[model samples]
Target chain A: MERTTIDLWVGVFVAMGIAALLFLALKVGNIGGFEAGSVYTTHANFDNIGGLKAKAPVKSAGVLVGRVTEIRFDNDSYQAEAILSLSSQ
Target chain B: MGVSTRFFFLLLLHSGTCFRRPQLILREIFSSGVLSLIIILVSGLFVGMVLGMQGYETLQTYGSEEALGVLVSLSLVRELGPVVAALLFASRAGSAITAEIGLMKATEQLAAMEMMAVDPLARVVAPRFWGGVISMPLLAAMFSAMGIFGGYLVGVVLIGVDEGSFWSQMQAAVDIREDILNGVIKSTVFGIAVTVIALFEGYDAPPTAEGVSRATTRTVVTSSLAILMLDFVLTAFMFRGV
Candidate 1:
């Protein structure tokens, strides 16, 4: 086989491998490329907090506006705080 | 044992030149990695589909069939993807490399290379070694991606699971750095263990027909065992807290 053909095949093989990794990262894992957009960070203090988990969808009028970034127990106030990272549209 | 250890060190020392010029390694990758692509992909799809069906069956009782994506992706990425891919790679590529090198040895090509003042370890072994190492993680990743897609097809399309919930659960569970990257690391280690053992067995085979055949068989059997053992050790270290 010519050297160029070998190089081409190897290039294709490597590209496929990289594409698979990207698919795993982006499609499967939900890890997107770095975003520098501003995110509105706010906290909501709920009495019960229910079964709220981190990364749970924070909905506004049944629309997903942001994600619940962290859920914390406030010892001082004896309340639950949900830190929401709202994407700025 | 001592000879194999020495061979391993010698191969490593000669590996610097293997990467300096990429042609040889590229050729090796073509033979091992490119050839194994179809097997990896087809097997991944079937495994994922089976996992989807079985997981749906079990999770259905709990009324949590939506978690099928989670079960499929987590299992594929964390365990099945790397372990099974390496096993296939060992049987497919590892045995082939052993046979090629073992036959070359039986034909006295290695001795001729030495007589011509060329180091067979450098000229022959290192490229295949690094080639298998390079192919392993990529093949594993491709296997996992194909598996997840298969799961999606089975779960959302065929089984009528909600598409939104299926993907969301998967994305939520399959962390790239934690789950996916660790699996890549595991496969890379398995790749190293497999290729090194294959090369050693082939290089050390007695220069006879039966010896070459036995070495080829040993490559498949030993490397498969090595892959499983290494997978256990790696999983213990990587997934300890999780």
Candidate 2:
């Protein structure tokens, strides 16, 4: 019984550690954010994404006011087209 | 043949032997899972704390202590966290695996398994190989994230950087795709390398207790060296175009 309780506590601590890690990743990665008043959408083309994923943050002038919503290859140019949603300035 | 060709030949032979037994290897991994988790968690916390302190001090001189968030997060997520976690895991787990297997071999357990038609590679090695593959990335992620938080605590709560600006700088500096992928890829490779080296040393150990001890020591040293070498190669290749 005591062993079981210790195991339970250990499990809880491990879970907390994992949760804290996930939170940090999300915070640093800027996964989800939606501001209240206004938002706009824009697109950019790049020759290579270099492992960029959907929902990766889009930065302009060093602030993360938006995130990438969609990514597709341009048929003609064969480049990545990223659709970004930005909060109004 | 050239020296490189001979080295390549030996590597191929080693890999072939390592892949022989899957199920037995997996069973060993399952048994050792809890111990591995504990080691990872403890080491990760220390790595994060040290990284935060160092990063904060460096950024202070430039009057960009706020950028410590960026520096810590970027460095940990991309490189240091994974490498350090892997090295720790290799030292702790790799040496243990080598010694355990070497002792079994010295005691003729391996020979018994072979005589009974049980493939030792499948039973003894493959599980460990896969365990390292799975565990290293998870551990790396944990280490990197914890390190970032440590930086946040030091940079914001202790050092007086505004919370908002610190977070912003961190968010700005991180290219999620590049950073995360770099860590995951390096750890995966490091895991495989560590497991292979440990298993190799164990299987090749001389037939005595002294031999097992020597093999354990070699496993730790070789795996640690391999982790650093692989980190450099992966960094150069992954970041070349970035």
Candidate 3:
């Protein structure tokens, strides 16, 4: 009976540990945050992105409506281009 | 003394034999680990609450209060979780381990076992050592999780930081492989270092009451210093490019 109690407690402890790892991976790491959804891609050109980065939120009217997907320098246009994936909502 | 210390460490190296039967190891874990878990959980909660309060006020000045979750989670997961948990483990479990073994030595129990042709190292020290090593990482993880929850409580419930923004921003910012996994690795290494030190100090202590007392004190001090130094080296190696 005592053995079972200890085993149960240790089992719970190990489960908690694994749950913490999963929380860190899924929530903090954003592993599954991006999923197949109604997303529209749009491109914008700027002289410079000014520290903007991929995965940075694209806000409109202080609302996060999309995220920056890709940023690159377009040699042909001699400008920085940013691709954004906007949620339909 | 030199010969005995080497012998103690050799026994530690082969301590994996203690795990041959899960039942023996589980008993050791119950005795040595339960208290440390409670300590880390309470400490983690308070630490996270403090971080949440502090992060909210500071970020509010810059209009970035939503970043509180990212700030609190990152700080706890990357640096504070392993470091603080290990320190607490050293003081609580580590000191207890040293004193327990030292007391046994002082009472000549270890010697009695040796006379009977029983290896005291394997029968006693190895189980305790393995218990500590197994406990540290789990304790650290619990600490981090409770800390994050504490931050959530303070930031979202009390401080009124937007809950969605707090969590979303944190998710976007922190990386599992880079931050959380590295922290787990750090705690595991710290666990090994602390348990080994505790066992070694106790095993090598002079078989006297005063000697046992001094060994307990040494367990905390030496393990703390070792933890800090190792944290520096590990942080340098793990985060060099980033």
- Name the top TM-score candidate: 1
- Model 1 chain A is weakest, by summed lDDT over 10 consecutive residues, at A30-39
Winner on lDDT between 2 and 3 is: 3
Best prediction by lDDT: 1
What is the TM-score (0 to 1) of candidate 1? 0.89
The deviation in Å at residue B220 for candidate 3 is: 0.5
Report chain B TM per candidate: 0.97, 0.86, 0.95
| Native contacts recovered by model 1 | 0.76
User: What is the C-alpha local distance difference test score of each model?
Assistant: 0.88, 0.72, 0.86
Task: For candidate 3, report its TM-score.
Answer: 0.84
Candidate rank order under TM-score:
1, 3, 2
> How does candidate 1 score on lDDT?
0.88
Q: Which stretches of model 2 miss by more than 4 angstroms?
A: A1-21, A33-64, A67-89, B1-27, B30-33
| DockQ class, candidate 3 | acceptable
User: What is candidate 1's lDDT per residue for B209-231, written digit by digit as tens?
Assistant: 89989998999899889888888
lDDT for residue B129 in candidate 1, whole number 0-100: 95
Q: Score the docking of each candidate (DockQ).
A: 0.57, 0.22, 0.45
How do these models rank on lDDT, best leading?
Answer: 1, 3, 2
Residue-wise lDDT of candidate 2 within B1-242, one digit each (tens)? 16433433454444454456444334444433345667666666676667668877877788877787788888888888789888887887788888888998999998999999976765565556665665666667777777776777767777677888788878756765677666777877887788778878887899799999999999889889989988888888887562
